[model samples]
Target: MKKINKLILMVMITATAVISSCQKLDMPPTNIFTPDIIFGSEAGVKSFLATIYRALPIEDFKYRPDQGFKVGANDWENFYNSASVTGEQVGPFGGMDIGGGFGYWPYKDIRNVNTLIEELPKYANKLGEAKVKSLLGEAHFLRAYFYFGLAKRYGGVPILTEVQDPGAPLESLQVHRDKEEATWDFIGAELDLGYQMMDETNETGRANKYVAAALKSRAMLYAGSIAKYGSVNFVDGLARAQGIVGIPADKANQYFTKAFDAAKLLDGHYSLYDKNSDKVQNYIDLFLKGDSPENIFIKQYSIVSGSAHSWDATMSPRYMTANALSRSYPTLDFVQRWGALSVTNTDGTPKRFNNRAELMEGLEPRLLATVYFPGATLRGLTFDMQRGIYPSFSGTAAAEVAKQPNTRSYILAGDTKTLYQGKMVIGFTGPWTGGDELTRTGFYVRKYVDAAKPIATVDLNRSEQPWIDLRYAEVLLNKAEAAMELGNASDALTAINLIRVRAGATVYNSIDIDKIRNERGMELAFENHYYWDLKRWRNADLVLNNTRFKGLMPYYVFSENKYIFLAEPELMQRNYNFDKRFYYEPIPGGELGKNPNLYPNNPNY
Candidate 1:
């Protein structure tokens, strides 16, 4: 059946040949389907351009692998989650034991962009200068974006400017990686070309001037931050402020200033999505409703008409959840992080609601608005918490499953007793259904799962929810942080307070240091930012030390004073040490075996 399915897809691609709608083809029909010939026509070119913007992540955490560890899915997360999976040097299993997400999408994007770079330029003159140049510019912006992704992940990666000919690909295939400095320079150069080549209003999703500028600023800020914090790259203790290492403080400011300028250009079109008319689920309303003005660049998902998996299965709990698919559980670690929000007092003291229940009870109303607590009796729900029956992960009561507690099982391999947060939050299992144990450290996400279309199906298009990539609110936080980091506290206060004032967040009347950070964690909770944000803030050691996994148990109990749900003594601890090498994931072992000359291994690997 798999073979048949593969064959059908191939046949479909062949049978549905796209034609050039804008101009006449000067080449033979055979050339029409060639990479160059196909993209040469205006309509064909537009289609290609559309294709580039269309690929996106439907699941909330594509780049984030932190949840994978929480779910106890594979060795990668196992290592990070438990701090038990160990090894520095590569023998059998030693690469990306810490965080392999860096290697996944960046390289995948590079390969795709390289294809765009190689194919588009050939038909430049033949297709007329303007059209050809526009497409090329889009490609350049995309390449720059890919480079940025790579740069953020691994310090440097192989910089392939062109597509390799399949017949003679070996030479380029085994090319060595570029120096980090050279790579960033090349990327900066690409951004320059992209900015010049693309137009903002005239361009679609493919690299517009504003997007390029925004991207450049983002790049500069990240590079600058890494360099400034001395976290960029290390060599013993000599913080190298040179080359590809980290952007110097002055350069960091320059990038932030540039980012501010680029953002200023976009100041007109975007704003925070504040339509909390329903008001009950305000936190969920802001991020998941999709109508909020806050979302600027979402990778749009048209479920029925698109190719990706519909979100129905993942968000909804089994029985009540539209499909019986497993829920993508967010851990107690994540929940507790948000609880850390109330740690700041409005009166300039730390109020610290470190306990889960206390955090939930004292939590700014925003948290409850976003979650579907078991037995929650808000106007939208009804269920018995003691019976292990609560609102479904899908948020509709009709689809929920009912089971006696002592009987045990939530329709998956994950154990239900691990329901420390799920039981408290949405009141459903992880919304999963494959095996039966249901092993996870957290609960299912209630942020985006709507009650309306609460059934799972093969169809992927559902307009009810639009994913938010970067909302204006995020920008506010981003700007505030940048300003604060750059010593512009007044601007930071204004930016931070906007969100607080709107949410009626009682924790801060104005920007308090702890309050602002807490606000970000709680407001942005489970939009998948916990682990990385912790790393960036340099709080990983304290946080990770407590996050370590043990034996095989999915949940971890922070020391009594730290958290409510504690880990059993028998849980597996996959790794023990936070070796610096664990920070960057090495290229996959599979690729390494193919070509040693590719410098096949991450330095430590």
Candidate 2:
């Protein structure tokens, strides 16, 4: 097993109390150490670094659309996620109507990182030069990461490279946001610098050369997409003049090339995890097993250290979860988009299934692995998701008349009964309403669930499963996307085919940008990638404009003794409108109030 270092544990345990105690009193307390005393020791430096790591917006298991990175205990009530916004999934209640906003301004964390970058050199004598450089690299990587998160959400933002004095003038402190291209360039430079300075060898759960490279691959890809596809007309002249939100189209290839190169650097170090013969189980285990080589970087958790999340408790099937509410319902649009599992079809056509039992037949393994469809088993319980049952009309006069609509014809009179005299009847899992735990869509989420954990007895914040943020498969997808954007179709197919083969799906003989995007959506579904992917590709408006995602309803035909499936509009009225201005999230109103220089907040605000 890969070990999470004791340093991380120490940081989690000590930093919260130390940082909190330091700020409790205005004046210097006798118990608290001065900055000089803190930075003078190696352990203190490690502690500081640990705090910064903890502050990072890694967007792990606890990430929610409404809450940003850190989730409150009650935030689970607003359970919609990135998948909910994207057409990939819906919530148990219905479609999430919440406004799209990611108010992430981690200036405090950035300031702390700037302070570390400035103070690290002072400790060079206590820590060896090599160690100091590594520390500096980590600090730089964190800064780059911080900015990248902002850039992806709000375009260019104020780049604070050094620590600012508390007494600094208001004019000096109100730094204007840079142009989008410059900010992205700065991020790339910082990641490159960290990659050059960091050691190839590092302990687990710490930033290494590969981690920096993976981040660069992801950041550069986002930059390239913005340059290639984003519209510049949304912002006003003043915002455009400051370079706050637009990139030149000419720079697209350069960013894509950088992303491709960065991804290629990890070729020998990591590959897709394919240890299990059962491909579906193998895909599930990819998220379940923390020690897999596929995970390039992860945010780990430990119940002993008081670090864990409630992902399984919140996302598991109703019967499986202690809370008994199934959030994040997989959508029929995503299921239909999975296409067929047949390897012989070069055109990527979806296969036809004659009956409900065969509905999942010829589907991609990843689809089966990602979504718990009707009749799928989870946590030792079969999900008998029968919307309703066909009435027994053999001898009745009502049966003699033509069949009514599937919705009106089926009866919810009792549990679904078969012909056997004493046989048990399976209850419907629903497309039902009037309850919290019932699924509005026909399916439930399956990815990122800890199958090993006992969900029925679990409580909040007790799940300790690690969340994989950067992995080999995503890097491969990145490489393929970049290559496709660069007009290298053959190379793109080669990279994407590796992912497809592992997913137990057909390999594409000829591919286009759309095909690559589709492949990415399937492979990385519900991992917090689809929404961003759609945004970066400039396709969200096209895909989600006034769209209501679809769902499937399964009904038991008692006379035929077989289940029949119908695909139609989801049970609930889901409205999704992606305004063009939403491509760039608005800067927080409070931040603008503090500094008027941070004006002209991203278009439609």
The predictions' CA RMSDs to the true structure, in order, are 10.8, 7.0
Error of 2 at 133 (Å): 0.7
Indicate the worst ten consecutive residues by lDDT in candidate 2.
Answer: 17-26
Query: lDDT by residue for model 1 over 521-558, one digit each (tens)?
Result: 76665554444455444444444443343211111122
- Per-residue lDDT of model 2, residues 375-423, tens digit only: 6776677777766655442223223222454525555433344333332
TM-score of each: 0.66, 0.87
lDDT on C-alpha atoms for all candidate structures: 0.45, 0.72
Superposed by TM-score, candidate 1 places the C-alpha of residue 276 at a distance from the truth, in angstroms, of 3.2
- Please report the candidate that would top lDDT against the real structure: 2
